[model samples]
Target: MKPTIIRPQGLPDSVSSPVVTPIMPSVVYASDTPDALDAQYEGRTSGYTYAREGHPNADVLARRIDALEGATGGIVTGSGMAAVTAALLGLCKAGDHVLGGDQLYGRSLRMMRDDLPRLGIETTLADPTDAASMEAALRETTRLVLIEVVSNPTLRLADLDGIAALCKARDILLVVDNTFTTPRAIKPFEQGADVVLHSVTKLLAGHSDVTLGWVAAKDPDLQRQLYDFIVTTGLTPSPFDCWLAERGLVSFDLRFDRAQRTAETLGRWLAGQAGVTRVLYPTRDDHPDRARAQALLRGTGGNMLSFEIEGGRAAANAFAAAAEGVAFAPTLGDVGTTLSHPASSSHRGLTPEARAAIGISEGFFRVSVGLEDPEALQDTFGAGLAAARGAR
Candidate 1:
């Protein structure tokens, strides 16, 4: 998700504390003296020499996110996957074992399963919701443990406290993907995560207009390690994207509150709908991990939820066609409501049997709730349910 380098406007001599964050797009900064340049390079002074190395916009966003996540320090990356890769590369060496939740985001699971192995880092997938299972999967060489605060598509909650405690006792770094449950709902650092990762492309950006991510480390040394990896690999995000993401953060709390409220309303409505067989929402009493959700999350279930339409792919497609205002977009965390079919989108890479084993049935549709009026949105979903029934 490399962005096109947009030439920035001419630099001003200085702006006296502009209300808005100014996007500094210069790829390189000039130093007044060789001593100063060496000082910056040696980390004896704070400065930006290259965009790939550091930039004011990224530094601002990183600081903001670090505060939000209660992290000791942080770094921004070009994308979510890049953040994951950077964290793993910084922390693990060849022969080190990385244990990740089986239900992590598809690409993340792929990186651990298929990609990291190539680098001589071994990865094991375990049930993140079950602390005992995670303990059983750990090996003497295990160096990192990864889990999503909430499983993708299914809305399953992970036992973060338990998992974090397990990792702490064993001296393994615990990485939690806070993409689904953004800091608005829960901060992984408070729950004992060594590193917190986000797809700023999602909720943190809110508008679905940016491709960026960040890694927040609980330790300063760990943050430097991740930062060095990002800079060395040229994985820093463009200044423009970082600026947009910062702007998005301005309304993140408000947008997330509204969307999550509507998600609760929609979840209740869908549970009683004609064609919906089951609904997966953290706030729902019947959710598989309700107890954990109650203990770990704020009162709200996140803005994301999934439901099983009566028919498989056919009903799902028919529902999408009839869900008037809702776009059948594969992505999530937009300001507008959109539907994603995991069978055909997020989890499509998995074999049919593999998906089924994880409860991602052909009929499942994950919804990224938005700021739409709840009643009207329910009406829209009602119409889609009728169409789904007809298709069945």
Candidate 2:
């Protein structure tokens, strides 16, 4: 008999060879034969031909998102806006009408209201929390309805089930941005959402190192179309970033759970504070849609919360300075707790009237709670509150 094998029993097989998924940075791939290459290009075989079309790393990340979002199929893109652009332009054509929630992300609103119109696709905005408002805004040509599970900056929870039902009855495709209320909180597809979107740069990545996005469709055909659009438009994300994001996803559950706990604690403490006029957290009793949030999110308030200062923008600035250790970053979803001013960062594109209409005022402070000690965060917040009061 031959000498005993030195390697492990399963190591020889490629499938079980490595515990960590490898990062494939190849811009181009080679096949065993010409016929195999043709088959790969024609979708007759499972393989990669070029990075622009697809890559193993991206596919790995996309499949993870599919599993998380409970989607039939999915694809990764360069950025959050790229995913939005591909989904809109690929599925809806000229003369097609789209209805968007008035409280959607700032860039998304700008795209629908300003950019899509130039492409002959028109959009209408309505209060996403009210199904009646959405129904009233729909046109005969309405093909899509877009809404966020939880609105940004202010963290308002939408009536996802109601809106999904409305879209289903009308045969309109319901696309939901699940960036805020990640898969850990709720699955929109179960509520009749046809498509789900994620800004992977935020909570999904958890580290704030990668800028990426993904689109998942309940319909396989729609997913194929979106993938084709992404490939043709070169909206594919970098393979390395996809690898990094995949690593981040490994710790997503732990991060999200910790953030959720801290957010709830902070929201309650802020509400009891003197300088805070209003605190908006989905799980809070005073939240406008607390009941809805409870039902949809399973009593879990997400990590994001916003509060208003007794003073306006000036007080907000003073609070930021007093809240030491909390970085005043314009972005969100990092492992470290951070603060963002929506009026200047996420909602800067909107007019002052539009911003005020959505209640995103100068003094509003949105916090993306991170894995920090609850008492420590409260101490910083207490100092910030005192500063705000003095500033006013």
Candidate 3:
């Protein structure tokens, strides 16, 4: 009358579970034959030679993410930016150029804008939501095109089909950052994506605890190259972080579903508020790219909302202070509803005019709806909106 997974042989055939993987923090592996070690070192064999190169926990997490993203292979990294940077480095040579989104996670933009150029890899920016703008930004030297599935802070949607087609026709790799939308909502690989990126710190893990990132690709050869690069650069995550992230994955859908429900309720409420300037959610009728979002994400809306108040930065700060349950987290995608101010937090490194150009105004604040009662969130966020109104 009970259902269970088939355990491997020698895994205690009784009620015991031998297949359940545990946190494996072993740094060095013991091998009897020199040939075995050499094979592992040379990538001829698929086995752990060292934790810095790969380990049990990271492998388990990577496999799960690989399956979820519909990729042939994947690898976990120390941090989200590490994953992105490492993948870019693996794909690009000294003279190669990259075309990336104008609206990205602040740190991601900064890395491409500042660091990549220093390494002789040029990066050009384009609004991925616009076909014409993206086409104009691509260069003959462009080897990769990076797109965020849902633009951070602003919640803009990317038209994946157009971008994918454009990149494919040019023999350029299309890498989709699926952190904002998560795999539960959208699988970029289905849209002709060459690879997919995730800040596993977000909805994939479904908790604010783990700091991890990963890249998944359909090509096994590319995966091997990425893994080799990871080993050479020491970009692997700790086994403990890998375990925690995988643990969070078990409940990701449940948490994301509940949070999305709350987000929808809060989005509708926020839009109707007299003092609120605008609410940005993919499902909203007023969203500029709602149709594109529907097409790419298969009608699944995300659990993120961006709103503006009348009083600019002052009001945004005051609003956070007034919220009853919503906490100000420098991060996004927490199981508990959290708030972030893009201008002062994530995108603070940019100039005022630069931030404004991306539709991030001084009054803009983003809300990552969590697994709270919709009514409670409405009350909490409503208080903040009301406070912002009073602050003006």
The number of the candidate with the highest lDDT is 1
In terms of lDDT, the poorest run of 10 residues in model 2 is 7-16
lDDT by residue (241-320, candidate 3, tens digit) is 89999988988888878888788888998888988888998888999889888877777787898998888877887898
- Residue pairs clashing in model 3 are none
For model 1, the superposed segments whose C-alpha errors exceed 4 Å read 1-15
Instruction: Kindly provide the TM-score of model 2 when superposed on the true structure, using C-alpha atoms.
Output: 0.94
lDDT of each: 0.89, 0.89, 0.85
Question: For residue 366, what is the lDDT in candidate 2?
Answer: 89
In the order shown, the candidates' Cα RMSDs to the true structure are 4.5, 4.8, 6.0
- For model 1, residues 1-392, the per-residue Cα lDDT tens digits are 97865755346687566899989888988787999999988989988888999899998888888878887568889999999998888889999999999998889988988899999999999998899999999999999999998999888888798899999999999999999999888988888998999999998998988899999788888888888888888998989999999999989889989999899999999998877889999988899899889889967688998999778878888889999999899888999999999899888888999999999898899999999999988989988888888988
**What TM-score fits each model?**
0.95, 0.94, 0.93
Better of 2 and 3 by TM-score: 2
How does candidate 2 score on lDDT?
Answer: 0.89
Q: Is candidate 1 or candidate 3 better by lDDT?
A: 1
Model 1: number of clashes?
0
Residue 123 Cα positional deviation in candidate 1, in Å, after optimal superposition: 0.9
